[model samples]
Target: MTVALPSILLVLLFALNLPVAFAIAISALSFFFLADGLPLDIFFQKMVAATESYPLLAVPFFVLAGSLMNAAGITRRLLHLADALVGHLTGALAQACTVLATLLGGLTASSSADAAMLSKLFGPEMLRRGYSAAFAAAITSSAAIITALIPPGIGLIIYGYLADVSVGRLFLAGVVPGLLLAGSLFLTTWWIARRRGYRPTRPHFAGWGEVGRAAKEAVWALLIPVFIILGLRYGIFTTTEAGAITVLITLLIGALVYRELSWAKLPGVLRETVLDTSSVMLLICAASAFGFYLAWERLPPAMASWMVGLTRDPQMLLLLINVLLIVLGTAVEGTAALIILTPIFVPVILQFGIDPVQFGIVLVTNLTIAGITPPVGQMMFISCAVLRVPMEVYTVEILPFLAAMTAVLLLITFLPGLSLWLPDLVMGP
Candidate 1:
């Protein structure tokens, strides 16, 4: 009754449109009060302890770095480079948007931020070029999914912290899969554009000199991710330190090199960072309390045993897990889902001899796809709001991109090498 009551309260609260963090925290508190002899003091301890993590510091640093990059005009430079590189392809603007998302994925970790930025940056132009609002929204929302798989990804950092996996290795492990997803999205965009006869943004291929010029302009912004990977691989810094270093570097580039991030802009960037960090940390605190309840009740082991009995084969187990994640993802916010479910799923996957790193990528990717899906998809809502497109229109247009991403997810799930190859080569197992 103790377990069922809390779970039911969580669902009921969610249905009533309460904030996720509050819902989780309230439900968890109920567990303490309802459970016979369970102490309430432990709840306070868990919530406080959850916010005291060093590794978790990466979230705010990375988020602030991204905000600084925006203030510094780094994103504009990268978009120009993406345009010079892929602006002649079919659905040229769409292709460049996807490329831009892939590149920014390294710099920024938030999918919704990427979607909102891209929608504003390219959504109007795509519409002016005769592209449907639905198509524009679909492409922008779906392309942002790439951000979740790329290095310095907030999702990867959180998963690494929660699952006891290596953040540096998870960063390296994401490279191939991230690029592969970009390629898949690129092809899907091209095929759809070709079929619909959507005109390319550029009349001709950009000259090499033009591409070179754009690259030169964006070189400092481009080097951010390169420096992060090298720094982590060579032991120059720990993951938390990497985030701090990234912010320092971005501030330098913005203030000194780009000359766009002014002293006046610094306060706003810090304010935004505080807000983003607070929201994430609060959710983490709430989830920690709920996770504590689950641990106290010994739910993970029971769930793991049940899963093992249901499927002894690793492949089948992975497939089943993916389906559940996708469904849950469609309903829950990705970060909330990650925090609440990782404890439950990690134990089961380990019993099947699954690599936690690979599972982390698969888990992050599946939830990312859900962010663009229907009903409760945050990315979908952001894109639709930006483009002024209806929900039904956005849902229909996102299907192909969704399928393409799903294909990549299945490939990563079945072929562990895709996720592990870079990590093994760079850091070893």
Candidate 2:
């Protein structure tokens, strides 16, 4: 009976078009009552436990920080700086969209938010520049996914909490793979631009004077992620406190430094932050109870034992896990997948001597790619809406980018050092 809960609950909730959070909670409650012999009160208890953590506070603060940065004009400035740097490249504006998305993602950590923002800011520019609407939508959506792997990423936060890994380390672990994905996507854009005769964004490179000016304007925007990582590394703050500090820093930049984030705009930012944070936290709380059901059934151990019987080799195990995540990602939200699946897989991977940090990067990277895949891809839908591109057109245009991202994912998976070396070098054993 316990063994049937994960699948049965999934089908039931999915059939009803329930929100993912409620689906998780209802399924978990069903299991608690039917098979686990647990009290109904455990559901509320787990909710309290899920919300009680200090680190969990980061969710709202970071969500708010991302909002504040947008309000403060940081996002606009970052776009200017990115355009100045890459705007001379072939397909320059498209590439700038990617770069700017990556930069703002560092602050926002939510791919959906990043994609929505880019759609508004860069979506029109791409259309004006003669890039096909479909291509622009595809690139914007795909580019925003780079944020999901960067430090302060909400996906990493969920993975950290569910798997009991250090949120800070997971944050650090994401840096290289995130940048690699960005570079690979850029190259793909260049190739497509050259083949399609996309015009260069600028006739001549901006001078040092312009570059310096853009960078100066964007400085405050750039330091938020760096401050979070350093604070966590030095024990100046936990991930939770760092989030509060992120809000403080963003307010200062928006209110004091930029002066663009006016008092009148405060309510809108707060409203959006609450909506986003509530959606995410509700999922976490629900996932916690669902996770408890899995534990109660002893599913992880059973699955781990079965997997070991199939293959004791670490690489084979990783390949299987990656394949599973890709399929799961198409149907499930990335955070939901990470919370539900990481526990089941991570222990199995560790048993085969795989580095948890390396696996974490590979895991998140695969899910990042999933965000752009079809049939319920949240980012894909967001991009299509923003650029007003038809699904079939954008899907075809996005293939090359997907292939490039896949290559990077495989590289990180096999070359464990790429993901782990920096973390080890900077953070030590």
Best lDDT goes to which candidate?
Answer: 1
TM for every model, in the order presented, reads 0.98, 0.96
lDDT of each: 0.91, 0.85
> Among these predicted structures, which one has the highest TM-score?
1
What alpha-carbon RMSD in Å does predicted model 1 have with respect to the real structure? 1.1
Off by over 4 Å in 1: none
Error of 1 at 13 (Å): 2.2
Error of 1 at 236 (Å): 1.1
Tens digits of lDDT, candidate 2, 289-352: 8888878778899899999998878888888888887877777867677777888887888789
lDDT of 1 by residue, 4-92 (tens): 88888988887786888999999999999998886899999999999889999999999999999999999999999999999889999
> How many clashes show up per model?
0, 0
TM-score of predicted structure 1: 0.98
